[model samples]
Target: MNARNAIDMTAPVQAPRDAAPASTWHSQMPDDKAMLRAAAELTRDIAVARPGIYWPDMLASAFVGYAALAGAILVSHPVAAVLLGLLSALALYRALLFIHELTHIHKDALPGFRMGWNLLVGIPMLIPSFMYEGVHTQHHARTRYGTVEDPEYLPLALMKPWSLPVFALTAILLPVALLVRSAVLVPLGAVIPPLRTLVWERASALAINPQYRRRRPEGDFARMVFWQEVGCSVWAIAVLAASFAWGWCPLLIALCVVSLTAFLNQVRTLVAHLWENDGEAMTVTAQYLDSVNVPPPARFSGLWAPVGLRYHALHHLLPSLPYHSLSEAHRRISQHLGEASTYRKASYPGLAPLLMRLARSTMTAR
Candidate 1:
């Protein structure tokens, strides 16, 4: 079946019903066929991934990030170092998010882009493409989304208020955690069979769900994982060795930069979804509503939610649409569907309101 046919978009668009109870909010909504069809038809021309855009953006972001990181480490002035470190974190965060595109782009769409990204941003960051490749796809699956099976989801809005802060704060330690995973656990896993299994199943993927356990990799994917693990291990050990041999200043600065990047990502992830569903599978329209879109006028969203992630709700509707094309795709669909359409319901004004909405939900959550 074609992409349009894949979604059950036969039902006509209707006024959104009165708010259901928090637990059943997403489960009861039906698909919006008019919005779905408009999205598919209006975006056909721009759907193809463009290598020209992809290569330059990735390369420039990587180059600027590494350069800023070097300046942060080498410059003696504390003020200059702080500015440079911030720049490095933002640039690298954008560069690293290309992994999201890698998962959706066809293998042939941009040959060698995956390897290029893994070398430039992935291994050095200790978050190789393999970590996200097979894992993130599960989040987009029809039946598994928002379920216990989904690696990328958790019902945060329904949890205690403290859970939200803890969820975001934990990401600040990711760089150190990654260092230990690669430098300590991975090397030990090479010799210990059980440790290898445990690490692979529990620590391999970039997942938010604590209960999700990854299966063993096989075929080409297994080979890819082996090589990526090797690269990360070697890089992690080298960084540690260099830190000890020289002063710890350089490594500490780099870790701080990565920590900021991770923290920003965690906050973005927090706002990406409404997190209202209580372990129930949602229809396409329901999923879109539960997700979010910080479109135009959300000035800072592009910095935090780079690489088309600002259109995350729309992304659920068209997972395979190239990142570079998301803005145009969003525009075409919004214009075609108009203000009263289901498509408009997903778009938010900015980040502050979304965060406030999530915080309010947590206060009343059962």
Candidate 2:
């Protein structure tokens, strides 16, 4: 059965943190050559991937997403169109896994063939392979407090009763944020050169401190961020060209589909880190326990958790493994870590109700 089918994403997820830390939670997932072992295991199992050029799965899904968006625009039945668009959005999230693979693996090592193929895979997802690679690398190196380690989680103190209103408002506002982002913000940010330059400068400064600019220009990082945008810009241009010569519907459909996928991606990211508190948890596990992932032997899990994010705790423990092999790596290690691995199967719909449940729980609890 498809792992996605195994998941009941729509039903209620049990309150995530109600169970006290796993019997083994006190023992952190091992980090001793874990990344190395993970890589070897994953490579032995998952297909030897071909980057830059279409990853067979990600490519097939990208076409599905694009076709669905087109259908959403032209198809007569609104409901079927919306369903297809939703499925496509989910498929696009999986496409992000190929991008994650590029971030983790060195493209040159694989096939002496197309290095550009690695970069090409990242564009449609709006992620710069280089920038994200660096950021995510640092994130894995130290998933804790202060400076650049954290993967952008809200501060734990953020869940005060007073803050409840804020999380609720933000949760409600998410869908609207997607529309504004894809339709207005993303498109405008691309067309306006001044805005684009400002963003680039700011990102460069962040990637490497300005004081160290002379030391590190982030050739890879900047290129990653740049081409990622370039891809989005190209996508935007295509939509506009079609809309102008034809009609607005196609463009609107494209924006809706892309944004919907991106929004779901964000939900997965935030929740992965949402429940943990700052001090000890940050120091030890970094973002591993805070992150959620579906383990492999179940690749289909990517539909709900992009980039093998479901196997996140395992990845954090073993960062060097290429994404394609995360599943097997996770499965092998999971026996050792057990629930300390944070391998839950809550459906996304169930996840929402669970999040709402936690909104009322102890700030430190899940």
Candidate 3:
């Protein structure tokens, strides 16, 4: 039997603060290199993807999302429009989750997937995958994972409760912000070299923390960023022109899709980690605990955390492992290491309890 199927997989009990200090959570855990080597050996056979399994699901998700959005716009009934909008949001959010995969999966390994996602989802959404490439790698780096340098890892536990609303509200306004960045900022940066350098370092990154500035891209990578930004600029202008010609309803519908997608992604990011690190460089074990894994038997987790992100701690352990292979990696690690392992401790019960825990912490801190 698969290790994941062996037992009822509820959230593992969190270790007490004294027993598991913030700085030393991984002290008793297995060596990172050895653990990964063992996991790699166990999952070697299952890591590779069958194109048949990969392509169809991705294409289907993209198609369904766009079709649902169209249904929202064309459907005359008010009830049908709201339902279609909700469905479109969920579907597009799932498709957008593929952006996380693009950060880990090499272009050569899944050539079709890379191009397909960019054309079908990225360009249309105005969030091209290239923006994430260099930035996401920093989040996976050993020393960088919980640090200020890690753009994706915000220490939400340290922030005031009021700031949480601001964090979430930013997502709702992301549609307008991204449009302005692409349509206006990108073009201005193109003509002015100094401004282009500043924009490349500051604005081009898709980062969670405002303080995490990006380095300038060079040569081939710079060219990739240039083209992707240009594509988004053109798309933004076209969207504006279409809205002007066809009227406000179409623009309103587009905003609904983008806004909902961004909001859902923000919520996922909130639950992705404990947000416990306080600018400290966490140990491998500490980092895993600081992160989260919403394990199986919780079926609804898949809807909120599509693309294997529910196994986020596992992804941290094996950043090179593809999304489709994360469950197997978790199983192998669980089977080899057993129930009380640090790996098991990272698993959470559900989103509500997790969010409640974070809220309680925020209150206590205040």
Candidate 4:
């Protein structure tokens, strides 16, 4: 169905007071049926892999992250330690963000990128690439995008004021939660069939919505899950054992780095969507409109929402486009579609403004 006829655009939204007054562009923009077709024709060539950019960006970010992590652990000065920890978190967060690309980028094109990521960052972080690959695709599925079946979605704007803080606070516990899930739950889940079922449905994926459950994976996907989980289980135990044998300093550094990254990721999640769908099945255009995109001129968006996530709405419109191409695609779209396009509605000023808007919305909802 075309966007104009199928999508709901009346959901309440408020721009941060400092933002340009909330635009009425959605009323003027072309429907998704046209937007999608245009995006496909315009980005077809750019969507192809440009490994020169991909390899260097991913590897360099991983290196900086690890080196900074080492500095955080070894440096004795408190100021140096904090700076190093923050650097580690940002770099590692960028590197780990590649997991999203893994879900969309074809394996044949990327070759060993997936295995390298899982070994270097994924298992060590207690979030195997398979965890995201298995579940994130469902978020892109048309029938499931904003429904209870979509693990990545939650209707935060419609919820009570108290629910918002609870959502943010969950990230504080992520490091411990991931460790327990991998080190303790994974092994038990293997031995106990019922527990295994529960783990498959819940703990196996990195998800936001509490009601979303994963279906059991099979064949190659199942194998990928098994090996990745096994790696995470081993890494978690080894880290724990090392802390006891060596010093708590190592454990502290790991916790601080992972927790900080996870916390930042949680905040990113908060602004990724307006969360106004309220369990309804939204049209592709409605979903894209409901999503947020923090465009250029927003300081540090390139760093904070790294891996092309700053263009989240555009990504929803064309899921197969690689991260490196999103900016170009957005540029092309904005230039061709003009200022009044619904695309403008998806764009936000920055993170602080978005969060303030969300907080205000939640209080009003309550």
Candidate 5:
């Protein structure tokens, strides 16, 4: 769900006609207090995370994903394999996105849901919950939301046009990169103390900011990271050994499926924000405006931005609102605030326009 830091800036760039002046890049927008009050008072009832929804949805998604992956690998027909692979990618993508929820929800909200998720999806996917737990919360911090300290934010709208494609495409390599990190670099780092420090700081978090170095995990988090690291290392080594001992076709197919999933997530991340912030500490209203919401009638927003992410702008408003409750929450606030409200400004019709707008913004970046 985080943007990848890959950009090819060698090409000649031209500024678009609508480009804003450099002096206006920092958000000076005042917080909309009425909208903020409505958001809090309207959604207080649905703020709690429901375990029933979380457990069933995650279990089903993982089941369907693995089943479809098995079908993709076993089916000899090229067309059938491609179709099944795509299905696997989408289902797993949804399952994997529960990691985002894990970060926001209280530790006691769902009891053992965190450990269950790791056993089922996180460790198996080589993306244990530790990578996101401490990291994503910082992105939601009041003073750090769009600043350089925010691991998930990047000023893509201020970059060269070519950077977008490169940023998106590079995510295809993430699965393989994670495999290398766990199977190769991690094991090596276990002996070399300096290398261990370097890997933990630089490669541990799922962050977009190239300069965002992670601090060492501590207490319970450190313990969790230790176990997750062991799990990933063992899993990765076993996978590589099996692939080598047998033919590499199955592993290759699995990697390709995961790569497709990562690519889809990267594309989703691209449109999740307006990406106009230039590292300034934004106000809450500014953060919400900078975020996006592809509300109903878009139809396919659910497919790309699952687990309440389509209401990302609303999420910035109420970070603890459970995924299943976002729609009802959105409706209450929207009707209360009316069409001309600042809340309405964050809602977009669909993905195409968002993409076109981002592309245009990049074209105008100086």
Candidate 6:
């Protein structure tokens, strides 16, 4: 999706004075199908036509070595432990970037490269990269329809004006949220039957559906999730074993699990679309609901926002483009989309502001 010039702040910027902002133009819903079709033209190589050891890839290699060193430092120096926590946070962020792709394409295009990459990247991040592919694939396929399952997205209406209070409460209770992610969500992905059932159900629904059968199911993003998770799980277990032997269980645990959740990945996703007209056909995860491009942490977070994730609208509109080319597509989309695009910038952010905007911004909805 191309981006547009910043809203003319100098202009009155009156949202149609007489008409309801709900006018269909506010629906400015890009012809998602058309965007997907254009993207299809470029999906031929989801990764680079030739994957080279670029700077990010090299940084990825350095990270693994850093993790190994982190284990030792965590026991020897408390400051090192905290610093490792930050580093782990950074690594987990990158892991999610791997997931963005895992959500987009299967890893079989270049198995040798993919397998090694997944093992190297997924393990330290504790993502179970392989398993994520399958589950996340299903997520993209049935996002809003049946997989109404992923609800970092609760209807703001349900919360009412109280939503603000609730969001405030949540900000303080964030540790609880992180606890749920680590103790519950991640573990369930590893051990529970019900969670696996969710994955299978999502997969089955997509398998039988027409629109979803777009890319081959096996090679779909689901597989990418599955393998990445697989690798992450293995690495996590290994980290535990090694740490236990080194008598650094607590430290290693913090590095592998606690810090992973602290990466704020879930926040990035949840706030992206937390409060929208949940009644309308939502894009599966509220993650697709509302998002902005060129957010605050662009340069620092670029590696973590794979496939032009900062270009959320574009990424959602055209998931097939190689991560590198998303910028070009986003540029084009901007010119065509103009102000039809929403959230001209990252004005209001975090769950609370987003919820407030959702309520006020209902100025319009499709």
By TM-score, the best candidate is 1
Residue 329 in candidate 2, Cα distance off native in Å: 2.5
RMSD of 3: 4.1
Which 10 residues in a row give candidate 3 its minimum summed lDDT? 1-10
Clashes of each: 0, 12, 0, 0, 0, 31
User: lDDT tens digits, residues 14-130, model 5?
Assistant: 132125454353455678999999999999999999999999999999999999999999999999999999999999999999999999999999999999999999999999999
lDDT, candidate 5, at 204: 93
Q: List the residue pairs that clash in candidate 1.
A: none
Please give, for residues 58-125, the per-residue lDDT of candidate 3 as tens digits: 88888999999999999899899989998988888888878888887766877678767888888888
Better of 4 and 5 by TM-score: 5
Better of 1 and 3 by TM-score: 1
**Cα deviation of 236, candidate 1, in Å:** 0.7
Model 4 residue runs over 4 Å out of place are 1-30
Off by over 4 Å in 3: 1-16, 19-37
The alpha-carbon lDDT assigned to residue 302 of candidate 2 equals 52
- Model 5: lDDT to the true structure: 0.89
Off by over 4 Å in 1: 1-19
Give each model's whole-structure lDDT: 0.88, 0.49, 0.77, 0.81, 0.89, 0.44
Comparing candidate 2 with candidate 4, which one achieves the higher TM-score?
4
lDDT of 3 at 149: 83
lDDT of 3 at 147: 81
On lDDT, the stronger of 2 and 6 is 2
Which residue pairs in model 4 clash with each other?
none
Worst 10 residues of 4 by lDDT: 1-10
Error of 5 at 257 (Å): 0.5
lDDT string for model 6 (1-366, tens) is 011123332122234322433223223433344444544554444435235533365357447545744563556776776666566655555544554564464354434654554555545544334434444444344334222443223444334554434443443333333334434455575578766555444432212222342222465555655555455445555655676787775544454544444334544453443244343444321233344455442353354343356566455545545566666665554455454433232222223343345555333332
- Per-candidate TM equals 0.95, 0.64, 0.91, 0.91, 0.94, 0.59
